[model samples]
Target: MNPIVYAIPIFFLMILIEVITTIIRKKDYYRVNDAINSLSTGMLNVTTGVIFKLGIYTLIYNHIALFSFDGNALWVWVLGFLLQDFFYYWNHRKGHEVNILWASHSVHHQSEEYNLTTALRQTSTSFLFSWIFYVPMATLGIPPHIFLTVSLLNLLYQYWVHTRHIPKLGWFEYVLVTPSNHRVHHAKNRKYLDKNYGGVFILWDRLFGTFIEEDENYEAIRYGTLKTLRSWNPVWANFHLYTEMLRDAIKTKSWKDKLTLWFRRTGYRPVDVATPMKMPDIHAYENYNPEASKGLKVYSLFQFAILVLATTVFMTISHNTPYGFNLLWTIVLALNLIGTGWLLEKYTGLIAVEAIRFVLSGATIFVSNGIWINLIPTWAWQFIIVSGAVSLLVLQASGIAKPGSNREGNTVRAAGS
Candidate 1:
């Protein structure tokens, strides 16, 4: 089954429930714009993985089928689930403990608000290490497709667990990864670090000694990595850990510490350093008081609604069209929305960005429709291209659109220490 196709409607329904629940609880936790941005990046990550996954699966299936073995055992399917979860537990745990893995996993942890959308904040580089964990399953004679399907199912099951709006489910907590358990996974509190490493099942973590239960004494959970990502740049969020590690390795005097920083532990504090850097206490900081400005809240909400609508329209269109053109357009649209939001958030001249995006969109649509090439003269394409370039330059020169006193800006200035 195509998990993406099946997961879309279910995902939106979950989001609806989360939004309604947040409203009833009088909490502004479900920021629709943020969710849309995260989801867009996450989808891009998954799409990037598809090519590698298909290639790997094909190679393994073709090679392994040559062996004289039964691949259709029901027990094999069951074992595939168990084995995949076990490997995932280790992969997830190492993602916290190893800087290299953390580079890929940090995308999920970068979001400060834990909700259904956070589940979509997946790493684009996950495929780099994901295959390593599943190789054991392939050796056990499970067909590649079965292994892939079960792995995806395990991932799909994890989406609901990202939400804080859902509370603890007593017995379900033991058997499966609940919102309560996974909330602990996202928490940066001392007690919650490296806990709850399960995918669909909590048993793996329980058996592996990585599980930590919720503690009321820890206070309300704070989301994000220990080294908080201070930027909203999705590309940087995905690659910052790697860049930091490389820089540290290059600067360090000791070869051992340099190597260890990448392979040994995530965001490791080097003892050999002349000066020790202190990690930020994200939990110590007070939450942004959105209540201070009712007008700003209303404007943010309006922008958020538009973002959600845009995402839905693109996703719906993506589902119906063939993968080639549809996928290309979907990415272009998603990036445009993300770029727009980023410009707005950074207070980086929104009009210029919008104008550039408008020209790009127009050129793409015109070329895609074969209007200039087919309907217009050959000379018109050159004119259209020049016009598009000029439009982009004009847009780039115009700065971001600032909201009036009626608008609360998206800039998140840290509260007093």
Candidate 2:
């Protein structure tokens, strides 16, 4: 069973509580746009993982484990958990220190606001290299099942540390990756950058000298990368760094710098192509907060709810469903996530993307002789149909639609457009 499936309800429930508490206290920690955008990235990560991760992980583990030790000792679980965290610390630290890895890992750190949803801001491409870090465990003869469970445990342990509501733990601060310690990891301050890389245990960082305690004297810890993403788009959040790398790789005169720039230290540029790109003064930089109308927000929420429902069914029944249908809906869900971000940013052509989404939802439900229809009650379907119809009317009146009439605007593909 996927650990995250069990945690999905708890995630939303905790997020709801966080939103309420922040509102009651009048704290600016939770933003509707940012939270939803983070969830969108997470949605993409899981939906795409079904295609990319499962087969690769199983194949690699099986090949490496035929001669592997089958340790069922109680200590194996505990030892496996500890060993996984040790590797995770380095994998995560190098993800920050290395250029190519940061291109994938930086997506999680790009959120300006620290909240529960920030935990869900995951990378779609990081798995490309992350799996290699665990090959030692496979060879050491730790059972692949143990490695898999421990990996999930290590991941789930880090989720709570993403919150701002928790203060430093007294003695646990020395051993575990407490919220205060992890906050420094996410901070962009020169002092905070590349610190506290532990996923579950702070012991590794303390021993390795990457630990940094939160300093009230320095400045308030700001959440995000030094080079801000400056947009709400999740797809761009994943690929923007790669695109920059590729663009730099194309422009550099020296083939050495062109090829090595990716593997070289992050932010390295050939002197010819490098210009003075200023990091925003932290004190003066403002968070991205585009104004989305109430109607649009409601429409986005409705679409997201339906997406969540579809995703849940697919994950539960993926082995039983047709592979083609699974891939189609997954890609559709990913595109709607992009559209969700565009709608929040008030970008061009959101209306058309959303119009296409509504059509897909209706078609998916009515086709296959009510395949999706059986997932819910008839009354619920009637309500969704009425609400979806009203949503289309609202989208037409929202004035965000006019751009769809233009060929260029309709096809605009870049982030922050």
Candidate 3:
């Protein structure tokens, strides 16, 4: 069973508790559009992972493992956990240092707000290369189950540290990763830019000289990337950096730079394509919090709830489904997320995308003879159809389908409009 299946409910419960805490404290920490956008990226990552998860680790373990260890041994479990953490530290650090890797890892830091949802903002493409870092555990004969368990545990450990409500721990700060340490990791301030890369333990950062304390008195930490992702489209968020890098590679005069630019340091740019751009004042920056109508917000929340349920269904049954069905389902889910983002951003002409999604969803059921996703009962699919139809009618009635609904002073237009 996927460990994330069990943690899904707990993740939402903690978010609910944090929401209440922030409300009682009268702090403006959560924004509906930003939270939903963060979650959209997460769903994209999860679904993509489900379809593309490789088995090279198990193959290597079976064929080339140096030594076999007893899976049930206590010490073996401890070793596996430590190994996963060590690998995660380097994977995360290199993710920030390398240009191509940063293209994938930056999704986690694109959010302008620091909240629990920010932890869910992940990259869909990191799986392409991240597994290379963990191959040593497989080669050393760590059982696949143990490695998987430790990985899930390490991931769950990092989730809680994304919140702002938690303060600095005293002695615990010196040992394990805490909220304070991770908040510094997500900040764009000069001092906190690439600090605190540990997943579960802060000792690695301290030992490796990457640790930096969160001193709010010296300068209030501003969140997000230096090149802000001003749009709420999750699909665009994942590919924007890659697109920029590709454009740079094409524009550079040197063939060596063109072929090797992605492997170079994070901020490296070719001399020919390097244009001096003004850096934003991090201390006085504002978040990309755009104006959203209450009706649109409610509609987005309702649609997101449906997507969450659909994602649960996807995760539950994807392992047993055929590759073709999984690929089709992944495409559908990606489009659903994109449409949700469009609604949240109040992007005009969403009706066209919704029409495509509606058609694909209907075909997913009909082409598979209504048995493609067995977890979703027939009644549930009917309910979704009814709900989507009603939503479309209501959206059209509210003028959301009109071309000028996203005019200035009313709603924020989509990026590049």
Candidate 4:
């Protein structure tokens, strides 16, 4: 079995344990709403990462046969880990410094809560430039398998660092990426900004002039981007910066300003706009309304549960199956996840959209089983499964399964309120 595939269950189980412990210990920071929001977004990010990785692997196979490089020596693994860390430091540092890279990396920081789930809240778009940072390792002749394994290891190592529950380990903070140092890295506080860009070794940050130790005077870490995502919409969370950049590009009179906005510092407000638009500060609305209506909670949780199941099934199929149908499954799963997230965020016209999805799912299943079963490849069956699951999710999100009375009342309330 692939180590990554094995690691998923273990990772989530660890998160579950942490959640339970947090509850029992009476930590007020364990926010279920935030967890749900983060998990939904994180799952989407992981799906995006998988798609990006597949494309990168294809490129590696065609252009750079790093898979054939010598990796038998123990030193090779050590060197690969160290080299990957060095590159990761730069990749991470640049992610903060550059606008385009920040657009890709910003998803990870969108969560206000610091926990194990936050570690999974990675960027889907990193595949575009991330590979560029690691190419030096490939050119240095690290075998592709070794490089890949070490990269995963480096990522897994960073996972435990993304929590507020874990305090600074005395001497450990000096050499390794600790929760304390990482918290500082995530903080929006001026002093902590763009510091501690290490995957496995904090020493690199110290050496490279990016290290900032946690300071009590700086106050509690304020998570998320300097400019916040005001909504829980996963699509907007992923693409907001890109959209903002595009908007600025179009509105600006100068082509140079357009190009500069894409590459320039994040939050570079252009001058000479007739009126400057103020972005909403989501942090200002941190007060939670009383628990949502019980019926809405149940409905949302049911849809959320379905989304999780569909994501797991998609991941399993993607890992175990061949590339052809896996890509199809991925696209379907991504759409399903996004759709469900949209529903959870209370987007308009969700019910009507999901009803159509249900009809389409039934049609596809019947057609595939009746006529196309014999003609299609075995992997194609997996694609059909993914499609059906996605359609079911869409239907649920659209409120096709919701009680008629509930739908009518919701509509009335929406109209009246």
Per-prediction TM-score to the true structure, in the order listed: 0.78, 0.88, 0.93, 0.80
Task: Please say which candidate is ahead in TM-score: 3 or 4.
Answer: 3
Model 4, which residues run further than 4 Å from truth?
Answer: 54-69, 273-291, 319-324, 347-417
All candidates in order of lDDT, best leading? 3, 2, 4, 1
Candidate 1 lDDT, 355-376, residue by residue in tens = 6665665566566556323532
Q: Which tens-of-lDDT digit does each residue in 196-270 have in candidate 3?
A: 999999999999999999885766667889988988889999999999989999998899999998999886788
Task: RMSD for all candidates, in order, please.
Answer: 6.0, 5.2, 3.5, 6.5
In candidate 4, the residue pairs with backbone N, CA or C atoms under 3 Å apart (3 or more residues apart, or in different chains) clash, namely: 350-398, 351-398
lDDT of 2 by residue, 1-417 (tens): 346787888888888898898888777787677788888888888877777654444566667654555468878778788889999988898898778999999999888788889998899997788977877766566777788889988888888888877877899999899888888888877677789999999999999899889775677777888787877678899999999989888998999988898888777777779874555566566666666655566767876777777677667766566665567667767776777777777646666766776676566555533554354345645765786677767778866445532222111111111
Model 1 misplacement above 4 A: 50-54, 64-72, 253-260, 269-279, 286-334, 366-400, 403-417
Off by over 4 Å in 3: 276-279, 370-377, 399-417
TM-score, prediction 1: 0.78
The predicted structure with the larger lDDT, 1 or 3, is 3
Q: Show the lowest summed lDDT stretch of 10 residues, model 1.
A: 288-297
lDDT of 2: 0.76
